[model samples]
Target: MTAGVQATVNDASGDPLGAHVALVIVVVMVFWAFLVAGLMFEPYRQFGHTGRLLQLTGICHLLTVLQDSRSWSLARVGDVASILMLGLLAHLILTLPQGRIISGRRRAAVAGMYAGVVAATAVSLRYGPGFDAGCDCFPPGPELSAAAQRGLLYGSAAFFWAYGLILGGVLIWRLLIRPHPAQRRSFSLAALTGALTIVGVGGRLGLFVMPGTPAPDGPYAVVYAATLTTMVLGPLGLVTVVVRARMHQASILDATVGDQGLLPPSELENALATVLKDPTVRLTGHPPVEPGRSGVPLRIAGDHVVHLTYSSALDGQPELIRSAAALARLTLRDDHLRAELADNLEAVRASRARIVQAGDAERRRIERDLHDGAQQRLVSLAARLGLALLQLSRGQHATATATVTAAVGELQDALEELRELTRGLHSPVLENAGLAQALASLAERSPIPASVMATGERLAPAVERAAYFVAAEAVTNAIKHSQAQRITITAEIRNARLVLTIQDDGIGGARATGSGLSGLADRVAALDGRLTVTSPPGRGTALVAELPSPPHDLR
Candidate 1:
């Protein structure tokens, strides 16, 4: 050991080996603290960094192997081993939690610098004029360039070994410091996992630094076993705790949503309770439900078409959406109601289909009647009037002239009336143009300011026609019943369903009586689609209708 280090150690420098060992232990302990923390907190990059550290640790182990089998020809090999140990120590300390964690371009630049320094030093150990004996930290050895080998050996031994013991001890004590809440059956899993992850790292590092030296000579084997156990079990313990916590949460959620097939009694109560995280959901109604049976019921004002809704915590939103759907489906389940709706739907189809065919046939008949009957007679009458006017022009009497002029005026009036009648028979423009142009004409003829917007992919012709009719009826109602000043129609396709909305600023008490809205509701129902009206008191009105992508039966 060097007399200078011995003298620096508090006057009584009798045992130089012990003092050197103390210094080695302190340095490695500080470095290990940061590395373990990085492993836990930064986890991903830190674990990646840990993998490199592990490789470095393995490198240190391999170096110890070479240092054991020292040779005369490979005399410079010990300096190479010492340099590798320096790199490994840097590996552990550099990625420690306290160390700056960096990534991407910045990390790459730093890594390149770190590599250059190591490469330069490694090249020097083989070629440059440098210390060539042993690990610079411990055991005074043969002088290469006049430095004691024991001075390096005893110092590294004192520093790294003592530091490893203290680090392991502190972490083990920390594990014993706090007991978990003990509230869950899974608390033991947490306690064991969290403690071991910390203690394992401490122990594993101790084994690496303390062994293969004169000081830890006999105690090395025992410490290594304990440290190794802590290292192996740490991850397993942590995973066990996490898995248990997840399982507990899943069980609680299953109990809340519904235990399989049971339907709830009161939707609103469960919704309110679930929001509050009240242990059990409370359904509305008397006869108090039991065994987690709260649910929403869907039924009509009268009839056995009743069903209750219980749902998984998925798909539908606002909790009550499932209830609303259930009610709609329930309304359709009554034998009589279903039959009536089916008949109503069939009637609508039959009526509109027949009306279209009848209107076309009637249009042809009216055109033929105008040409063959009224138009022919008017043409003959015009010929007769022309002949009489010609007579008057060729010097007829005054009384005859007056009579011909009056007769010509009466023919003109009759022709005007016939033209108005033909226009009313059925609009030719409505048949020639598609629904949008027809609606534009209809809107131009309206009292209110109405507008329509269509976006997204367009719908099938029949669906567009139904939507057009609905908009027209809504505009008409806005003017007649609701006293609305302005109305807007919006149509779009979202996720294969066609959505049509009619919104109006009007006095808001509109009901689905036998008028066109009721017809629209029946029409949508016939398509196996849905119709909803939100006309809140004093809040104006909105009518929403959704139809399937393929509304009409393909057959």
Candidate 2:
């Protein structure tokens, strides 16, 4: 009532939804932006490429354009923001070639062209024209119009962006309509971000080109009353979104996950296979991957031996070991209590492998059952029904009457059962509709209460599969081990990777190595993924797994 009254009795008139709500959205958005800088660090970071960061970036950028945007014009900040945005976009485009998938100069060249525009514009502002004014893109006086080519070039870039947006919007439409795309990984981050930037550009200027403008005496008059607001805030939105991507990646690396690039791939692989894979390896870091693959194969040298305290609490008094011994002891257990924990660890490991194999076998068995059993029955039944109908039409009514009626009804039931079986066994919706929908189905069917959230605009099949399996495993574990009430599963795709997180509020003291969670980590690692289990004795268990989102999505 208060809001309605204030709006009704307001002195100004304009777009209430557009101006007022847009302004509030902007304020809320700007405030929400603190999270992104923590997520976008490096590829291997813990906080890297997350969903919240991505969403915040997009929202905050749009919010800056709502009202009083022009007053934001400050010294070199705008230029720096523009440069960072252009660099980020250019990096995205250029990295496609570096990723070795594109293997062509075309995309890289496009990146260079965009970067060149930034450089040229910067140079023109400094030397070619209006050198006295600071790095502000918008000037208040008549002298600002003197920098003609800079404006034209900048405007042209915006126009190109608008074109890209139009083209991308079409692609988004296509993906949505025929979402069960035959191909996956066809979509890229570069494409999504570019499309968003284009949308931002066109949206900011869309009103002017419309058939008619809202009366200037309306609510938005307060919003557009100052030219600086739009000029500064409009483009800032795009910049914020892109920069936020970087921040997200950075934050993850430092806080959540370490920069594994510090170790060579082979070495890190060995370390994980050796220490981390050990079923008996308590909450410690140490191991030998395989029987002969131990002692750091001559080929694998480096080690990032971050301390891992193994069962120090329940078991009491933790022991520390060097990189090599830690790796060995962590896996095989070389201490006095090792014998006691051995059976438990082995059981955990065995259960982990068994669950994985059983899941696969179940799927195969169900598939075979359908193919060999129900399908054949349906085919035969269909033929029998058809033959009966033919006989009845040919004036053999008495002969065909019972058989035709029975066969027809049987066929309908068989088909329905097959459909139900299929839905339960494996979802075609998951395969065709993609991971997000598949997870939604899983959440609905979860015996234990569960909530699932998917983050990517689009996902590759491998990623979708990884996410599906991870959630399945997590939920299964929650039911069998944790005795938890609710499980929350989140799948976020960012920078060619998918991070799967499953958490439950249940009994504490759940050990990853001794419980189903340890095996879950091993499974993820086998697929070149990483898993982290955070279960403080009394706190709820939080499980996180990171899997490589294929550079090329194969649907």
Candidate 3:
């Protein structure tokens, strides 16, 4: 009985220090599971599938711990469960960051891993010993024939070594090579954890398979320590990655708030790309319709104004995308307003310059008209008068009388030319009698059969002058350019504005930019008015000028 007790004690305490360490590790893992599970809850609730995978991975680790138990039934159950969960671990690793499997190839690979693990577990259950006789902690196996037992041991061992190597190789290949720069650190850590797990577990399995290997105590303990370290670090690493990602999202949102300046389209896109860590990010006026492309609509005041397109890497975090889009909408709106204000200011500057230039040209034209017309006529009249006085002094009565009569005719011609020039400058009739009578005078002077219909209401001097000039310019254009038979001018106060309309039953091709019409438009615009010309081919021409005409007291 004493000898039996000694044997039992030796079996139970093969590696006391290692057992104590493993116990501490198990306790740490338990605490870690609760802590990490709490952290993963939100991700799971929001993105259900990813959280589920993480839960399954945690379960697999728990079963892995159970596989180290001294109870035979518990060890056997844990071994089978852990083997079945290998595929889940692979699936979780491959589909990290993104919760769902995106590609068919990866899905098929995970499915194949599951099938292989099932087949391997079935073969072991059917043909292999349930427990290792050399280890007191291992579970008992089914009674099997010697040849069948050997086949199970060698085949399962070989398959598992290949499986571990393949899984480690695939994890490293998928995550380490050309991984997204933003996710590189997480991928690297996950890859390192997976590689360490495979090495530690595979090395321990290799020790058991070697010929003439003694009971696994010294080297087994070292392998076990490495395995426990990896298990502890794996979940911790994942937690770190998740926490870091959350912080990253927060930082991005904070950065957007800091960018309060008016950002141009290109600059806005660049800033968003920088914040999202996606160079493929773009801001577009319309939503993207291409395959593999996703867009977030940015709405302002319940109206969708623009779209934000980004890489699919950001698809996992819809909250982040929405927040970014809201901020982008504000930036884009401000940018548009700033651009419009700049354009308006530039247009005003250009309009003022054109007005000044037109004024200078008009002055030069008036000077030329006086020099070539009234001035010449006046000079001729003076010469004729001087000649008439000379004739009178020489006692030539008949010639002097004829010279004075010619001088009187020349003086009349000069006065008429001066009146015409002054009329062009600012019509006295418009100032004295308002727009209605001024339009009547314009129509009467027009060569075509013309009629005037106007309300006799007085208007602001500037408005009346603008309306009169619009009518005069329209009449002149119609007479000079339009082959019209009849012209109509109408002026009235409508909706607090002086509405002047001129229609001609003539050739319908008057351009608003024509020399006479352009000047008229400028005159109307100076008083905050608008001039519209409609002259479609084969249709009669019409000119409508609208000038603001408030009540006299308001003006």
Candidate 4:
């Protein structure tokens, strides 16, 4: 009997160390598991608030686990902190993917949830039973009447149960209301994990409040297993999301860079949308400034080429977005260049058509002028000469001399009219002399009091022609329509480009789209120049034309 008792005492003494070691190992394993989750989440912190919140949730879970350690004296602190952490978890659920409390109502709801948790914790710590009847792990609560304690416990349990139900319902609603199939797919696993966690915790709390519940040994094992499973699945779910995001990023890169030919803007947008699972994705040449929209600029060689805009729901996947942008930089840049080239070619075609049409109209005008003025005068001169010949043959000397003199006068007038018409077709002064001489001659002919200022630089024929026409058209318009007393024409070479300005002090309601000005604009644009007309009502009109003038040798 004595030997048996001694053996029993030795056995009992050895078991405590083994149990303590086992507990330490369990704690170490939990700590390592949470640590791994934290490390996994660390890389995503730069992406957005979602990653940071996930890390925070993992830390809170670790702390909650520590609170159950008998060796750690953290029960009193854990009681309040753990409940608050759970409230944070609830908040995290509602703001999944983005992890932003987007609305005042949602912020208020989260605040109220924390407030309820605090109130419940106060009641549970004060009047409610502190010691679990099943596990007997906690110390006894303060002395209270049975009725008060029971009522408080039931109230706290009811509040927690409502919290769980509301969170679950919210998860379901989020799943139901998600408009995008991609969003639903991305949110499903996390939401399911969160729902399971709520169920496990609510089940344990429900069992805790029951009367005459047995120890947490037999029937309660399943609930414990479920709670533990939920804890493990929570971190796993987060890891899965991150992994999936990385995979999506890889796919985005492939879709953007794999194509041999440049994708059109529409096709590029479609490709990104399909890969990212966002139907709201689009490409724009300008920044997105709309509410609830986010933009990622695709740049090449430090120049912004285009912007990628999408719904704010995808804010959580910043790395994925950035990777796609990086890969698409060259492609988007090429596409932008191609689009610009297409626009320029179209403009060139339209300008050429307009020029051809203008040439045709000018030819028709020349034909009409010849038939009406020079040709009619020549025919009249022919008849007058025939009359003079008839007089000479009849030996009427004075009559014949008068007829001949009249014919000479008519012939001189017809030649002068033809000279004027030829000058109208192409100015001799402009073709022979430089732009300065051209402008001077133009100013001298203007109906209004006009002045000319030019640098007297010889330019390419095309440049000289454009400049001359711009000045002539401006002077004519000022005379005909502006009713101005004075007109100014200034041309100078700045940065190897001709900057011409035509200013008039007149009624300044001139529009760039007016027939004369529009034609002049097209002429200027044909030389890769810009024409700006600033004619505010009641202000003087200023028509400025900037045209490229390459070096003399280059031209």
Could you say which candidate leads in lDDT? 4
* Deviation in Å, model 4, residue 19 alpha carbon: 6.2
Residue pairs clashing, model 4 = none
In candidate 4, how many Å is residue 16 off? 7.0
Per-model clash counts, in order, read 36, 38, 1, 0
lDDT of 4 by residue, 1-555 (tens): 222223233334565455444433433443454456556756774324555555565566556545455653676545545676667667776675556787898889888888887777566555443333333334674566777667777887787777777887787567435534665665577668767767666655545554344343444445545655565566566566667767787787677655476555557778888898878888787888989889987765456557888887666566777776765676766866787889999988887888788778878988999999889989999999999999999999899999889989999989998987776557889889888998999889777989988987788888888988888878878888887889999999988899999999998999988767877888999888999999987777999999999786224
- Write the residue-wise lDDT of candidate 1 on 1-555 in tens digits: 132223234223455456445434432433353344324433333124543454444344344324333474344464455455544444433333223345465455346435643554443332232223233333454444323333333344343443334433432332233322212233344335434433433343333333233233234323433443433343343334335534534543443344442223333345334432333433322322444333444444464334333332211122233433343344334434657789988877875775566557657878887787677767767776787777777777675676577667767766775764554443444456644565566567678887867653445656656666666667767778777888887777666677888888888877755445666676676666788888887778899988776533211
RMSD of each: 16.4, 32.6, 11.6, 10.8
Model 2: how far residue 479 lies from native, Å:
4.7
Please rank every candidate by lDDT, starting with the best: 4, 3, 2, 1
User: 1 or 4: which has the higher lDDT?
Assistant: 4
Candidate 3 clash pair list: 130-141
**Number of the candidate with higher lDDT, 1 or 3:** 3
TM-scores of the models, in the order given: 0.38, 0.28, 0.51, 0.56
